[model samples]
Target: MQTSTETETFGFIVNDISRLIRAEMDRRTTEAGLGLTTGEGRVLLNVRRFGPTRQNLLAERLGVEAMTLSGLVDRLESKGYVERQPDPADRRAKLVTLTDEGEAVVCGMEPITAAIRADAARGIDPDDWQLLLAVLKVARNNLMAARAEAQSAESAAA
Candidate 1:
Protein backbone atom coordinates (compact mmCIF):
# COMPACT_ATOMS: atom_id res chain seq x y z
CA MET A 1 0.00 0.00 0.00
CA GLN A 2 1.28 3.46 -0.90
CA THR A 3 1.56 6.02 1.89
CA SER A 4 -0.12 9.41 1.51
CA THR A 5 3.31 11.04 1.07
CA GLU A 6 4.27 8.54 -1.61
CA THR A 7 1.30 9.20 -3.95
CA GLU A 8 -1.33 11.87 -4.57
CA THR A 9 -4.80 10.90 -3.43
CA PHE A 10 -7.66 10.75 -5.95
CA GLY A 11 -9.77 13.43 -4.25
CA PHE A 12 -6.92 15.89 -4.00
CA ILE A 13 -5.94 15.45 -7.65
CA VAL A 14 -9.53 15.72 -8.87
CA ASN A 15 -10.23 18.81 -6.79
CA ASP A 16 -7.00 20.54 -7.83
CA ILE A 17 -7.78 19.89 -11.46
CA SER A 18 -11.32 21.24 -11.02
CA ARG A 19 -10.01 24.39 -9.36
CA LEU A 20 -7.41 25.01 -12.03
CA ILE A 21 -9.94 24.52 -14.80
CA ARG A 22 -12.36 26.97 -13.21
CA ALA A 23 -9.60 29.54 -12.78
CA GLU A 24 -8.50 29.17 -16.38
CA MET A 25 -12.05 29.45 -17.66
CA ASP A 26 -12.56 32.56 -15.55
CA ARG A 27 -9.45 34.15 -16.97
CA ARG A 28 -10.28 33.27 -20.57
CA THR A 29 -13.86 34.44 -20.26
CA THR A 30 -12.71 37.77 -18.86
CA GLU A 31 -10.16 38.12 -21.64
CA ALA A 32 -12.83 37.29 -24.21
CA GLY A 33 -14.96 40.21 -22.94
CA LEU A 34 -17.93 38.01 -22.28
CA GLY A 35 -19.01 40.45 -19.53
CA LEU A 36 -20.07 37.58 -17.30
CA THR A 37 -19.01 36.32 -13.91
CA THR A 38 -18.08 32.66 -13.81
CA GLY A 39 -21.25 31.82 -11.92
CA GLU A 40 -23.36 33.79 -14.38
CA GLY A 41 -21.71 32.05 -17.33
CA ARG A 42 -22.32 28.68 -15.74
CA VAL A 43 -25.97 29.60 -15.25
CA LEU A 44 -26.32 30.57 -18.87
CA LEU A 45 -24.66 27.38 -20.09
CA ASN A 46 -26.82 25.21 -17.84
CA VAL A 47 -29.96 27.03 -18.91
CA ARG A 48 -29.11 26.25 -22.49
CA ARG A 49 -28.27 22.67 -21.65
CA PHE A 50 -31.52 21.98 -19.77
CA GLY A 51 -33.79 24.07 -21.99
CA PRO A 52 -36.26 26.33 -20.16
CA THR A 53 -36.01 24.74 -16.77
CA ARG A 54 -37.72 25.91 -13.60
CA GLN A 55 -35.42 28.12 -11.52
CA ASN A 56 -35.54 25.85 -8.49
CA LEU A 57 -34.69 22.80 -10.57
CA LEU A 58 -31.88 24.60 -12.27
CA ALA A 59 -30.45 25.66 -8.90
CA GLU A 60 -30.61 22.06 -7.70
CA ARG A 61 -28.81 20.86 -10.81
CA LEU A 62 -26.12 23.46 -10.36
CA GLY A 63 -25.62 22.59 -6.69
CA VAL A 64 -26.37 26.13 -5.60
CA GLU A 65 -29.00 27.62 -3.34
CA ALA A 66 -32.21 28.85 -4.97
CA MET A 67 -31.73 32.40 -3.70
CA THR A 68 -28.17 32.50 -5.03
CA LEU A 69 -29.35 31.26 -8.39
CA SER A 70 -32.11 33.85 -8.38
CA GLY A 71 -29.52 36.62 -8.05
CA LEU A 72 -27.47 35.20 -10.91
CA VAL A 73 -30.59 34.89 -13.03
CA ASP A 74 -31.49 38.46 -12.24
CA ARG A 75 -28.11 39.70 -13.41
CA LEU A 76 -28.23 37.60 -16.57
CA GLU A 77 -31.78 38.75 -17.25
CA SER A 78 -30.75 42.38 -16.82
CA LYS A 79 -27.95 41.79 -19.34
CA GLY A 80 -30.51 40.42 -21.84
CA TYR A 81 -28.87 37.01 -21.74
CA VAL A 82 -31.74 35.21 -20.06
CA GLU A 83 -35.42 35.68 -19.40
CA ARG A 84 -37.58 34.26 -16.68
CA GLN A 85 -41.10 33.35 -17.57
CA PRO A 86 -44.00 32.01 -15.59
CA ASP A 87 -43.79 28.24 -15.46
CA PRO A 88 -46.85 26.93 -17.28
CA ALA A 89 -46.96 23.82 -15.15
CA ASP A 90 -46.52 25.72 -11.90
CA ARG A 91 -47.84 29.25 -11.87
CA ARG A 92 -45.90 30.17 -8.76
CA ALA A 93 -42.52 29.10 -10.13
CA LYS A 94 -40.53 30.68 -12.94
CA LEU A 95 -38.78 28.96 -15.83
CA VAL A 96 -35.48 30.33 -17.13
CA THR A 97 -34.68 30.50 -20.83
CA LEU A 98 -31.81 31.85 -22.85
CA THR A 99 -32.67 34.90 -24.91
CA ASP A 100 -31.39 35.44 -28.46
CA GLU A 101 -28.70 37.62 -26.97
CA GLY A 102 -27.90 34.85 -24.51
CA GLU A 103 -27.59 32.36 -27.35
CA ALA A 104 -25.15 34.68 -29.08
CA VAL A 105 -23.08 34.99 -25.92
CA VAL A 106 -23.02 31.22 -25.59
CA CYS A 107 -21.78 31.04 -29.15
CA GLY A 108 -19.09 33.55 -28.32
CA MET A 109 -18.07 31.41 -25.38
CA GLU A 110 -17.60 28.32 -27.51
CA PRO A 111 -14.10 29.09 -28.74
CA ILE A 112 -12.86 29.96 -25.25
CA THR A 113 -14.30 26.76 -23.85
CA ALA A 114 -12.83 24.69 -26.68
CA ALA A 115 -9.40 26.25 -26.23
CA ILE A 116 -9.41 25.60 -22.50
CA ARG A 117 -10.48 22.00 -23.03
CA ALA A 118 -7.74 21.50 -25.60
CA ASP A 119 -5.18 22.95 -23.24
CA ALA A 120 -6.32 20.66 -20.44
CA ALA A 121 -6.20 17.62 -22.69
CA ARG A 122 -2.78 18.52 -24.05
CA GLY A 123 -0.30 15.62 -23.92
CA ILE A 124 -3.01 13.14 -22.97
CA ASP A 125 -3.75 10.37 -25.46
CA PRO A 126 -7.28 10.42 -26.92
CA ASP A 127 -8.04 7.04 -25.42
CA ASP A 128 -6.78 8.16 -22.05
CA TRP A 129 -8.94 11.26 -22.18
CA GLN A 130 -11.99 9.14 -22.93
CA LEU A 131 -11.11 6.84 -20.06
CA LEU A 132 -10.70 9.80 -17.71
CA LEU A 133 -14.13 11.09 -18.64
CA ALA A 134 -15.68 7.68 -18.07
CA VAL A 135 -14.04 7.42 -14.67
CA LEU A 136 -15.23 10.86 -13.62
CA LYS A 137 -18.76 10.08 -14.70
CA VAL A 138 -18.76 6.94 -12.61
CA ALA A 139 -17.41 8.86 -9.64
CA ARG A 140 -20.08 11.55 -10.01
CA ASN A 141 -22.82 8.93 -10.18
CA ASN A 142 -21.54 7.22 -7.08
CA LEU A 143 -21.53 10.48 -5.14
CA MET A 144 -25.03 11.32 -6.32
CA ALA A 145 -26.28 7.93 -5.24
CA ALA A 146 -24.68 8.35 -1.85
CA ARG A 147 -26.24 11.79 -1.42
CA ALA A 148 -29.66 10.41 -2.31
CA GLU A 149 -29.30 7.62 0.21
CA ALA A 150 -28.28 10.09 2.92
CA GLN A 151 -31.19 12.36 2.12
CA SER A 152 -33.63 9.44 2.21
CA ALA A 153 -32.32 8.37 5.56
CA GLU A 154 -32.67 11.90 6.97
CA SER A 155 -36.23 12.12 5.66
CA ALA A 156 -37.08 8.78 7.20
CA ALA A 157 -35.63 9.85 10.54
CA ALA A 158 -37.55 13.08 10.51
Candidate 2:
Protein backbone atom coordinates (compact mmCIF):
# COMPACT_ATOMS: atom_id res chain seq x y z
CA MET A 1 0.00 0.00 0.00
CA GLN A 2 1.14 3.53 -0.71
CA THR A 3 1.96 5.47 2.44
CA SER A 4 0.00 8.57 3.46
CA THR A 5 3.05 10.61 2.43
CA GLU A 6 2.78 9.26 -1.09
CA THR A 7 -0.91 10.10 -1.20
CA GLU A 8 -0.21 13.67 -0.07
CA THR A 9 2.39 14.03 -2.80
CA PHE A 10 -0.14 12.88 -5.35
CA GLY A 11 -2.80 15.22 -4.05
CA PHE A 12 -0.60 18.31 -3.95
CA ILE A 13 1.04 17.91 -7.34
CA VAL A 14 -2.26 17.07 -9.05
CA ASN A 15 -3.99 20.02 -7.43
CA ASP A 16 -1.14 22.38 -8.25
CA ILE A 17 -1.23 21.55 -11.94
CA SER A 18 -5.00 21.81 -11.99
CA ARG A 19 -4.82 25.25 -10.42
CA LEU A 20 -2.10 26.52 -12.73
CA ILE A 21 -3.96 25.36 -15.83
CA ARG A 22 -7.29 26.75 -14.72
CA ALA A 23 -5.93 30.10 -13.57
CA GLU A 24 -3.93 30.58 -16.74
CA MET A 25 -6.90 29.57 -18.87
CA ASP A 26 -9.08 32.11 -17.10
CA ARG A 27 -6.52 34.84 -17.60
CA ARG A 28 -5.90 34.14 -21.25
CA THR A 29 -9.56 33.78 -22.18
CA THR A 30 -10.38 37.07 -20.55
CA GLU A 31 -7.77 38.70 -22.74
CA ALA A 32 -9.38 37.13 -25.82
CA GLY A 33 -12.26 39.68 -25.79
CA LEU A 34 -14.99 37.22 -24.90
CA GLY A 35 -14.59 37.95 -21.19
CA LEU A 36 -16.46 34.72 -20.74
CA THR A 37 -17.26 33.32 -17.37
CA THR A 38 -15.59 29.96 -16.72
CA GLY A 39 -18.89 28.18 -17.30
CA GLU A 40 -19.39 29.90 -20.63
CA GLY A 41 -15.90 29.08 -21.76
CA ARG A 42 -16.42 25.49 -20.62
CA VAL A 43 -19.58 25.26 -22.71
CA LEU A 44 -17.69 26.44 -25.77
CA LEU A 45 -14.73 24.19 -25.06
CA ASN A 46 -16.87 21.09 -24.54
CA VAL A 47 -18.69 21.77 -27.79
CA ARG A 48 -15.38 22.04 -29.58
CA ARG A 49 -13.76 19.17 -27.75
CA PHE A 50 -16.38 16.52 -28.45
CA GLY A 51 -17.78 17.76 -31.73
CA PRO A 52 -21.57 17.97 -31.64
CA THR A 53 -22.96 16.69 -28.37
CA ARG A 54 -26.40 16.42 -26.82
CA GLN A 55 -27.19 19.05 -24.22
CA ASN A 56 -27.59 16.42 -21.55
CA LEU A 57 -24.22 14.91 -22.38
CA LEU A 58 -22.61 18.31 -22.22
CA ALA A 59 -24.09 18.85 -18.78
CA GLU A 60 -22.92 15.46 -17.65
CA ARG A 61 -19.40 15.99 -18.96
CA LEU A 62 -19.19 19.39 -17.41
CA GLY A 63 -20.41 17.93 -14.11
CA VAL A 64 -23.09 20.55 -13.98
CA GLU A 65 -26.79 20.05 -13.50
CA ALA A 66 -28.85 19.95 -16.68
CA MET A 67 -30.88 22.96 -15.63
CA THR A 68 -27.76 24.96 -14.83
CA LEU A 69 -26.25 23.95 -18.13
CA SER A 70 -29.47 25.09 -19.77
CA GLY A 71 -28.78 28.60 -18.51
CA LEU A 72 -25.15 28.37 -19.59
CA VAL A 73 -26.21 27.25 -23.05
CA ASP A 74 -28.74 30.04 -23.22
CA ARG A 75 -26.02 32.57 -22.52
CA LEU A 76 -23.67 31.00 -25.05
CA GLU A 77 -26.42 30.89 -27.68
CA SER A 78 -27.15 34.56 -27.12
CA LYS A 79 -23.47 35.30 -27.74
CA GLY A 80 -23.85 33.66 -31.16
CA TYR A 81 -21.02 31.35 -30.25
CA VAL A 82 -23.06 28.16 -30.27
CA GLU A 83 -26.06 26.72 -32.02
CA ARG A 84 -28.49 24.14 -30.78
CA GLN A 85 -30.22 21.90 -33.23
CA PRO A 86 -32.46 18.89 -32.91
CA ASP A 87 -30.47 15.71 -32.52
CA PRO A 88 -30.79 13.48 -35.56
CA ALA A 89 -30.51 10.48 -33.29
CA ASP A 90 -33.34 11.66 -31.08
CA ARG A 91 -35.75 14.28 -32.32
CA ARG A 92 -36.45 15.60 -28.86
CA ALA A 93 -32.79 16.00 -27.94
CA LYS A 94 -30.78 19.10 -28.75
CA LEU A 95 -27.27 18.87 -30.18
CA VAL A 96 -25.00 21.82 -29.61
CA THR A 97 -22.44 22.86 -32.19
CA LEU A 98 -20.06 25.73 -32.55
CA THR A 99 -21.21 28.44 -34.91
CA ASP A 100 -18.92 29.47 -37.75
CA GLU A 101 -17.95 32.49 -35.72
CA GLY A 102 -17.47 30.29 -32.71
CA GLU A 103 -15.32 27.95 -34.74
CA ALA A 104 -13.23 30.87 -35.88
CA VAL A 105 -12.78 32.04 -32.34
CA VAL A 106 -11.88 28.58 -31.21
CA CYS A 107 -9.37 28.22 -34.01
CA GLY A 108 -7.83 31.51 -33.11
CA MET A 109 -7.74 30.66 -29.45
CA GLU A 110 -6.06 27.34 -30.02
CA PRO A 111 -2.58 28.73 -30.49
CA ILE A 112 -2.98 31.27 -27.76
CA THR A 113 -4.27 28.62 -25.42
CA ALA A 114 -1.38 26.41 -26.39
CA ALA A 115 1.03 29.17 -25.57
CA ILE A 116 -0.51 29.53 -22.15
CA ARG A 117 -0.41 25.81 -21.57
CA ALA A 118 3.18 25.72 -22.67
CA ASP A 119 4.02 28.59 -20.36
CA ALA A 120 2.40 26.83 -17.44
CA ALA A 121 4.32 23.71 -18.30
CA ARG A 122 7.55 25.65 -18.64
CA GLY A 123 10.52 24.97 -16.31
CA ILE A 124 9.56 21.30 -16.29
CA ASP A 125 11.68 19.08 -18.49
CA PRO A 126 9.87 17.54 -21.46
CA ASP A 127 10.57 14.09 -20.11
CA ASP A 128 9.23 15.11 -16.74
CA TRP A 129 6.08 16.43 -18.35
CA GLN A 130 5.64 13.14 -20.16
CA LEU A 131 6.15 11.19 -16.97
CA LEU A 132 3.78 13.48 -15.07
CA LEU A 133 1.10 13.08 -17.69
CA ALA A 134 1.48 9.32 -17.55
CA VAL A 135 1.14 9.31 -13.79
CA LEU A 136 -1.84 11.63 -13.91
CA LYS A 137 -3.56 9.44 -16.44
CA VAL A 138 -3.18 6.44 -14.17
CA ALA A 139 -4.39 8.50 -11.23
CA ARG A 140 -7.44 9.49 -13.19
CA ASN A 141 -8.20 5.88 -14.10
CA ASN A 142 -7.80 4.80 -10.52
CA LEU A 143 -10.12 7.49 -9.23
CA MET A 144 -12.71 6.71 -11.87
CA ALA A 145 -12.50 3.00 -11.13
CA ALA A 146 -12.82 3.64 -7.44
CA ARG A 147 -15.85 5.83 -7.98
CA ALA A 148 -17.50 3.20 -10.12
CA GLU A 149 -16.84 0.51 -7.56
CA ALA A 150 -18.23 2.66 -4.79
CA GLN A 151 -21.35 3.43 -6.75
CA SER A 152 -21.87 -0.21 -7.59
CA ALA A 153 -21.45 -1.21 -3.98
CA GLU A 154 -23.91 1.41 -2.83
CA SER A 155 -26.42 0.38 -5.45
CA ALA A 156 -26.24 -3.23 -4.30
CA ALA A 157 -26.44 -2.24 -0.66
CA ALA A 158 -29.47 -0.13 -1.36
Candidate 3:
Protein backbone atom coordinates (compact mmCIF):
# COMPACT_ATOMS: atom_id res chain seq x y z
CA MET A 1 0.00 0.00 0.00
CA GLN A 2 2.90 2.37 0.68
CA THR A 3 4.73 4.09 -2.16
CA SER A 4 8.49 3.45 -2.27
CA THR A 5 9.26 7.14 -2.00
CA GLU A 6 7.03 7.59 1.04
CA THR A 7 8.48 4.54 2.79
CA GLU A 8 12.02 5.69 2.10
CA THR A 9 11.50 9.24 3.32
CA PHE A 10 11.55 8.51 7.06
CA GLY A 11 14.65 6.32 7.00
CA PHE A 12 16.80 8.36 4.60
CA ILE A 13 15.96 11.71 6.13
CA VAL A 14 16.61 10.52 9.69
CA ASN A 15 19.80 8.68 8.72
CA ASP A 16 21.16 11.70 6.84
CA ILE A 17 20.42 14.04 9.72
CA SER A 18 21.99 11.64 12.22
CA ARG A 19 25.12 11.32 10.12
CA LEU A 20 25.46 15.06 9.71
CA ILE A 21 25.00 15.63 13.42
CA ARG A 22 27.76 13.14 14.24
CA ALA A 23 30.07 14.71 11.66
CA GLU A 24 29.49 18.16 13.12
CA MET A 25 30.10 16.87 16.60
CA ASP A 26 33.35 15.27 15.45
CA ARG A 27 34.44 18.54 13.86
CA ARG A 28 33.68 20.54 16.97
CA THR A 29 35.43 18.01 19.23
CA THR A 30 38.60 18.16 17.12
CA GLU A 31 38.45 21.96 16.83
CA ALA A 32 38.22 22.14 20.59
CA GLY A 33 41.43 20.10 20.87
CA LEU A 34 39.63 17.41 22.84
CA GLY A 35 42.17 14.83 21.69
CA LEU A 36 39.40 12.33 21.09
CA THR A 37 37.84 10.85 18.02
CA THR A 38 34.07 11.23 17.83
CA GLY A 39 33.62 7.59 18.77
CA GLU A 40 35.94 7.90 21.76
CA GLY A 41 34.17 11.02 22.87
CA ARG A 42 30.91 9.18 22.70
CA VAL A 43 32.24 6.37 24.89
CA LEU A 44 33.64 8.87 27.38
CA LEU A 45 30.32 10.62 27.59
CA ASN A 46 28.46 7.35 28.16
CA VAL A 47 30.85 6.26 30.89
CA ARG A 48 30.39 9.63 32.51
CA ARG A 49 26.62 9.41 32.19
CA PHE A 50 26.23 5.89 33.51
CA GLY A 51 29.03 5.79 36.03
CA PRO A 52 31.25 2.70 36.35
CA THR A 53 29.77 -0.14 34.31
CA ARG A 54 30.72 -3.31 32.48
CA GLN A 55 32.21 -3.06 28.98
CA ASN A 56 29.57 -5.34 27.51
CA LEU A 57 26.83 -3.19 29.06
CA LEU A 58 28.39 -0.05 27.69
CA ALA A 59 28.64 -1.66 24.27
CA GLU A 60 24.95 -2.47 24.41
CA ARG A 61 24.03 1.06 25.40
CA LEU A 62 26.20 2.50 22.62
CA GLY A 63 24.95 -0.03 20.06
CA VAL A 64 28.51 -0.86 19.08
CA GLU A 65 30.35 -4.13 18.64
CA ALA A 66 31.90 -5.40 21.89
CA MET A 67 35.30 -5.66 20.23
CA THR A 68 35.08 -2.06 19.09
CA LEU A 69 34.11 -0.93 22.56
CA SER A 70 36.95 -2.95 24.01
CA GLY A 71 39.42 -1.22 21.71
CA LEU A 72 38.12 2.19 22.64
CA VAL A 73 38.30 1.37 26.34
CA ASP A 74 41.80 0.07 25.95
CA ARG A 75 42.90 3.25 24.20
CA LEU A 76 41.23 5.40 26.78
CA GLU A 77 42.80 3.38 29.56
CA SER A 78 46.27 3.79 28.13
CA LYS A 79 45.65 7.51 27.81
CA GLY A 80 44.88 7.63 31.58
CA TYR A 81 41.25 8.49 31.05
CA VAL A 82 39.69 5.25 32.27
CA GLU A 83 40.58 2.19 34.27
CA ARG A 84 39.17 -1.30 34.36
CA GLN A 85 38.69 -2.89 37.74
CA PRO A 86 37.24 -6.27 38.64
CA ASP A 87 33.57 -5.75 39.27
CA PRO A 88 32.88 -6.33 42.95
CA ALA A 89 29.65 -8.04 42.15
CA ASP A 90 31.21 -10.25 39.53
CA ARG A 91 34.94 -11.00 39.70
CA ARG A 92 35.04 -12.30 36.13
CA ALA A 93 33.46 -9.12 34.84
CA LYS A 94 35.39 -5.86 34.72
CA LEU A 95 33.93 -2.47 35.38
CA VAL A 96 35.11 0.55 33.41
CA THR A 97 35.31 3.69 35.51
CA LEU A 98 36.53 7.15 34.67
CA THR A 99 39.66 8.46 36.29
CA ASP A 100 40.27 12.07 37.32
CA GLU A 101 41.52 12.81 33.82
CA GLY A 102 38.47 11.16 32.33
CA GLU A 103 36.28 13.28 34.56
CA ALA A 104 38.05 16.34 33.21
CA VAL A 105 37.37 15.25 29.64
CA VAL A 106 33.73 14.70 30.52
CA CYS A 107 33.54 18.17 32.04
CA GLY A 108 35.21 19.70 29.01
CA MET A 109 32.68 18.02 26.73
CA GLU A 110 29.62 19.55 28.40
CA PRO A 111 29.99 23.01 26.92
CA ILE A 112 31.01 21.71 23.52
CA THR A 113 27.99 19.42 23.41
CA ALA A 114 25.73 22.22 24.56
CA ALA A 115 27.11 24.54 21.93
CA ILE A 116 26.65 21.93 19.23
CA ARG A 117 23.08 21.28 20.32
CA ALA A 118 22.34 24.99 20.44
CA ASP A 119 23.79 25.44 16.98
CA ALA A 120 21.71 22.60 15.62
CA ALA A 121 18.53 23.95 17.14
CA ARG A 122 19.31 27.57 16.36
CA GLY A 123 16.12 28.37 14.52
CA ILE A 124 13.83 25.91 16.25
CA ASP A 125 11.33 27.02 18.85
CA PRO A 126 11.81 25.48 22.30
CA ASP A 127 8.27 24.14 22.35
CA ASP A 128 8.65 22.51 18.98
CA TRP A 129 11.96 20.98 20.06
CA GLN A 130 10.30 19.50 23.12
CA LEU A 131 7.52 18.05 20.99
CA LEU A 132 10.03 16.59 18.56
CA LEU A 133 11.91 14.95 21.46
CA ALA A 134 8.68 13.45 22.77
CA VAL A 135 7.84 11.95 19.38
CA LEU A 136 11.31 10.52 18.96
CA LYS A 137 11.24 8.97 22.42
CA VAL A 138 8.01 7.16 21.55
CA ALA A 139 9.49 5.91 18.32
CA ARG A 140 12.55 4.62 20.13
CA ASN A 141 10.45 2.82 22.73
CA ASN A 142 8.38 1.21 20.02
CA LEU A 143 11.48 -0.06 18.26
CA MET A 144 12.90 -1.44 21.48
CA ALA A 145 9.67 -3.23 22.23
CA ALA A 146 9.60 -4.75 18.76
CA ARG A 147 13.18 -5.96 19.17
CA ALA A 148 12.38 -7.54 22.51
CA GLU A 149 9.36 -9.27 21.01
CA ALA A 150 11.41 -10.66 18.17
CA GLN A 151 14.12 -11.88 20.52
CA SER A 152 11.55 -13.57 22.69
CA ALA A 153 10.04 -15.33 19.69
CA GLU A 154 13.44 -16.43 18.49
CA SER A 155 14.36 -17.82 21.88
CA ALA A 156 11.11 -19.75 22.08
CA ALA A 157 11.69 -21.28 18.65
CA ALA A 158 15.20 -22.29 19.66
Candidate 4:
Protein backbone atom coordinates (compact mmCIF):
# COMPACT_ATOMS: atom_id res chain seq x y z
CA MET A 1 0.00 0.00 0.00
CA GLN A 2 1.16 3.51 -0.74
CA THR A 3 2.03 5.49 2.34
CA SER A 4 0.43 8.89 2.96
CA THR A 5 3.65 10.62 1.96
CA GLU A 6 3.83 8.60 -1.24
CA THR A 7 0.23 9.47 -2.12
CA GLU A 8 0.89 13.12 -1.42
CA THR A 9 3.82 13.14 -3.81
CA PHE A 10 1.73 12.06 -6.80
CA GLY A 11 -2.01 12.44 -6.25
CA PHE A 12 -1.69 15.57 -4.20
CA ILE A 13 0.52 17.18 -6.80
CA VAL A 14 -2.22 16.83 -9.39
CA ASN A 15 -4.82 18.21 -6.99
CA ASP A 16 -2.66 21.08 -5.87
CA ILE A 17 -1.78 21.98 -9.46
CA SER A 18 -5.46 22.17 -10.36
CA ARG A 19 -6.19 24.41 -7.36
CA LEU A 20 -3.26 26.67 -8.16
CA ILE A 21 -4.27 27.05 -11.77
CA ARG A 22 -7.82 27.95 -10.76
CA ALA A 23 -6.53 30.46 -8.23
CA GLU A 24 -4.32 32.08 -10.85
CA MET A 25 -7.19 32.35 -13.30
CA ASP A 26 -9.43 33.81 -10.62
CA ARG A 27 -6.83 36.44 -9.86
CA ARG A 28 -6.27 37.27 -13.52
CA THR A 29 -9.98 37.42 -14.28
CA THR A 30 -10.56 39.83 -11.38
CA GLU A 31 -7.58 41.96 -12.41
CA ALA A 32 -8.93 42.16 -15.96
CA GLY A 33 -12.17 43.70 -14.61
CA LEU A 34 -14.32 41.10 -16.31
CA GLY A 35 -16.97 41.76 -13.69
CA LEU A 36 -17.07 38.06 -12.90
CA THR A 37 -15.89 35.83 -10.12
CA THR A 38 -14.21 32.62 -11.25
CA GLY A 39 -17.27 30.59 -10.31
CA GLU A 40 -19.50 33.00 -12.20
CA GLY A 41 -17.24 32.85 -15.21
CA ARG A 42 -17.36 29.07 -15.08
CA VAL A 43 -21.15 29.16 -15.03
CA LEU A 44 -21.26 31.61 -17.91
CA LEU A 45 -18.92 29.54 -20.03
CA ASN A 46 -20.94 26.38 -19.38
CA VAL A 47 -24.16 28.17 -20.28
CA ARG A 48 -22.61 29.54 -23.44
CA ARG A 49 -21.45 26.09 -24.45
CA PHE A 50 -24.63 24.19 -23.63
CA GLY A 51 -27.21 26.82 -22.92
CA PRO A 52 -30.93 26.96 -23.24
CA THR A 53 -30.62 24.19 -20.71
CA ARG A 54 -32.73 23.51 -17.64
CA GLN A 55 -31.42 24.74 -14.30
CA ASN A 56 -31.24 21.25 -12.79
CA LEU A 57 -29.32 19.96 -15.77
CA LEU A 58 -26.97 22.91 -15.69
CA ALA A 59 -26.35 22.29 -12.01
CA GLU A 60 -25.57 18.64 -12.76
CA ARG A 61 -23.20 19.60 -15.53
CA LEU A 62 -21.43 22.05 -13.26
CA GLY A 63 -21.26 19.47 -10.46
CA VAL A 64 -22.92 22.00 -8.17
CA GLU A 65 -26.06 21.91 -6.07
CA ALA A 66 -29.28 23.26 -7.56
CA MET A 67 -29.49 26.07 -5.00
CA THR A 68 -25.89 27.08 -5.63
CA LEU A 69 -26.50 27.21 -9.36
CA SER A 70 -29.73 29.12 -8.77
CA GLY A 71 -27.83 31.78 -6.86
CA LEU A 72 -25.25 32.10 -9.60
CA VAL A 73 -27.96 32.29 -12.21
CA ASP A 74 -29.69 35.03 -10.22
CA ARG A 75 -26.52 37.08 -10.07
CA LEU A 76 -25.80 36.56 -13.76
CA GLU A 77 -29.38 37.39 -14.64
CA SER A 78 -29.19 40.64 -12.72
CA LYS A 79 -25.94 41.52 -14.50
CA GLY A 80 -27.57 40.92 -17.91
CA TYR A 81 -25.30 37.98 -18.65
CA VAL A 82 -28.05 35.41 -18.71
CA GLU A 83 -31.81 35.09 -18.70
CA ARG A 84 -33.92 32.36 -17.21
CA GLN A 85 -37.08 31.54 -19.03
CA PRO A 86 -39.76 28.98 -18.34
CA ASP A 87 -39.12 25.84 -20.33
CA PRO A 88 -41.70 25.64 -23.07
CA ALA A 89 -42.02 21.90 -22.67
CA ASP A 90 -41.77 21.93 -18.90
CA ARG A 91 -43.20 24.97 -17.20
CA ARG A 92 -41.87 23.85 -13.86
CA ALA A 93 -38.36 24.07 -15.22
CA LYS A 94 -36.39 27.13 -16.29
CA LEU A 95 -33.93 27.35 -19.15
CA VAL A 96 -30.82 29.48 -18.98
CA THR A 97 -29.69 31.34 -22.06
CA LEU A 98 -26.93 33.85 -22.57
CA THR A 99 -27.83 37.43 -23.35
CA ASP A 100 -26.11 39.83 -25.77
CA GLU A 101 -23.89 41.14 -22.97
CA GLY A 102 -23.01 37.60 -21.98
CA GLU A 103 -21.96 36.84 -25.52
CA ALA A 104 -19.79 39.94 -25.53
CA VAL A 105 -18.19 38.96 -22.25
CA VAL A 106 -17.40 35.53 -23.68
CA CYS A 107 -15.82 37.10 -26.72
CA GLY A 108 -13.76 39.44 -24.55
CA MET A 109 -12.54 36.42 -22.60
CA GLU A 110 -10.66 35.08 -25.60
CA PRO A 111 -7.63 37.31 -25.14
CA ILE A 112 -7.58 36.89 -21.39
CA THR A 113 -7.86 33.13 -21.75
CA ALA A 114 -5.13 33.09 -24.35
CA ALA A 115 -2.79 35.06 -22.13
CA ILE A 116 -3.39 32.74 -19.22
CA ARG A 117 -2.87 29.66 -21.35
CA ALA A 118 0.32 31.13 -22.75
CA ASP A 119 1.61 31.85 -19.28
CA ALA A 120 0.76 28.37 -18.10
CA ALA A 121 2.46 26.82 -21.09
CA ARG A 122 5.55 28.98 -20.85
CA GLY A 123 8.79 27.00 -21.19
CA ILE A 124 6.93 23.83 -22.14
CA ASP A 125 7.37 22.39 -25.59
CA PRO A 126 4.25 22.55 -27.73
CA ASP A 127 4.22 18.79 -28.24
CA ASP A 128 4.59 18.15 -24.52
CA TRP A 129 1.80 20.53 -23.71
CA GLN A 130 -0.44 18.82 -26.22
CA LEU A 131 0.35 15.43 -24.75
CA LEU A 132 -0.25 16.69 -21.22
CA LEU A 133 -3.62 18.10 -22.22
CA ALA A 134 -4.62 14.83 -23.85
CA VAL A 135 -3.64 12.85 -20.78
CA LEU A 136 -5.54 15.18 -18.51
CA LYS A 137 -8.63 14.85 -20.68
CA VAL A 138 -8.62 11.08 -20.28
CA ALA A 139 -8.01 11.37 -16.56
CA ARG A 140 -10.94 13.76 -16.25
CA ASN A 141 -13.19 11.41 -18.18
CA ASN A 142 -12.20 8.50 -15.96
CA LEU A 143 -12.98 10.49 -12.85
CA MET A 144 -16.34 11.55 -14.24
CA ALA A 145 -17.22 7.97 -15.05
CA ALA A 146 -16.28 6.87 -11.57
CA ARG A 147 -18.50 9.55 -10.06
CA ALA A 148 -21.39 8.50 -12.28
CA GLU A 149 -20.95 4.87 -11.30
CA ALA A 150 -20.95 5.79 -7.64
CA GLN A 151 -24.09 7.88 -8.05
CA SER A 152 -25.79 5.05 -9.90
CA ALA A 153 -24.89 2.57 -7.17
CA GLU A 154 -26.21 4.90 -4.49
CA SER A 155 -29.45 5.44 -6.39
CA ALA A 156 -29.93 1.73 -6.84
CA ALA A 157 -29.22 1.00 -3.19
CA ALA A 158 -31.68 3.64 -2.14
- The CA lDDT of each predicted structure is 0.91, 0.84, 0.90, 0.86
Q: Name the lDDT of candidate 3.
A: 0.90
Q: How do the residues 19-96 of candidate 1 rate in per-residue lDDT, one tens digit apiece?
A: 887788799999988888888988989988889999988999888999999999999999999999999888998999
Give TM per candidate.
Answer: 0.90, 0.80, 0.90, 0.84
When 3 and 4 are scored with lDDT, the better candidate is 3
Among these predicted structures, which one has the highest lDDT? 1
Count of backbone clashes, every candidate in sequence: 0, 0, 0, 0
Q: Which is the winner by lDDT between candidate 1 and candidate 3?
A: 1
Q: What lDDT score is found at residue 97 in candidate 4?
A: 95
lDDT (tens digit, per residue) of candidate 4 on 1-158: 87454656647878787677678768877887887877788788888898688999999887789999999999999999999999999999899999999999888777877887898899999999999999989998999899999999999999
RMSD of every candidate to native, in Å, equals 2.8, 3.7, 2.2, 2.5
Q: Candidate 1 — which residues are off by over 4 angstroms? A: 1-7
Q: TM-score for candidate 2, please give it.
A: 0.80
Off by over 4 Å in 4: 1-3, 6-11
